[model samples]
Target: MSVEATGETRSVVTAATIREILVERAGVDPDVFTGNELLSLAELQIDSLAVLELQAVLVERFGVEIPDESVTMTVGEIAAVANEDR
Candidate 1:
């Protein structure tokens, strides 16, 4: 379901959305993610190629354009940014 379809009543921020994307794409163990935790690509073993894949997924899934400035963000930070954009 799309984020809106979740019927959560509260708005989902870009940071949260990005966090969800990471969780799904990285196969991150749920217990390890708080959606507000600092996420390190190196720690997660995510490579440059994987980052590109993530960019594609975020665009496709959320229809939000990710800018170059966003590349420096951690997973949680990205979601927060996304929330602001939406």
Candidate 2:
């Protein structure tokens, strides 16, 4: 429950890490994208199963548990939350 031992945490998440994950999962080039851009499913060509995979990857990488119901249908939301956690 304590984040003290893990050292200080930051309120903002790094754009680089999020970009990397997006590139890896969504196949969108991170170099051309910014965090503010809305990532639609059609744009990323992501399906339902891919979404679950992305969620798992986020949880595993960031140590944050995102409820299945809370996983928005847009990549932007996921990036925002993950960035904050990071």
Candidate 3:
């Protein structure tokens, strides 16, 4: 997503980025992630440990944090948190 600046927009972590992270860092099967960005981690059967692991990757890659240990969040939600934290 992009944040409106003075006269320009700044890009931030997006659902697509989160999807990539989930796929690469969290070992989320690409076939499973093909569902939708709105699908919750729980619905995808992503474990809490993977959630924490994803958070670490977020911090290292995007310099952002999701604020809490929540595996029930969707990629869109995680991206929203990353955008806000950034």
Q: What is the C-alpha lDDT of each candidate?
A: 0.59, 0.56, 0.77
Please provide, for model 1 over 1-86, each residue's C-alpha lDDT reduced to its tens digit, 9 standing for 90 to 100. Answer: 65578864544545556556656785655554454367555455555655666678867765655555554567666666555635
Residue 56: error of model 3 in Å? 0.4
lDDT string, candidate 3, 1-86, tens digits: 34345555445888888778778887878788775667788888888878888889888876677856557788888788778734
lDDT of 1: 0.59
Winner by lDDT between candidate 2 and candidate 1:
1
> Judged by TM-score relative to the true structure, which candidate is superior, 2 or 3?
3
Best by the lDDT measure: 3
Query: Top TM-score: which candidate number?
Result: 3
Q: Supply candidate 3's per-residue lDDT for 12.
A: 86
Model 2 residue pairs with clashes:
none
Clashing residue pairs for model 1: 13-83, 14-79, 14-80, 14-82, 14-83, 15-79, 15-80, 16-79
Residues forming the 10-long window of minimal summed lDDT in candidate 3 = 1-10
TM-score per prediction, in order, is: 0.52, 0.52, 0.76
The alpha-carbon root-mean-square deviation between model 3 and the true structure, to one decimal in Å, is 4.4
When summed lDDT is taken over every stretch of 10 residues in candidate 2, the lowest stretch is 65-74
Clashes of 1: 8
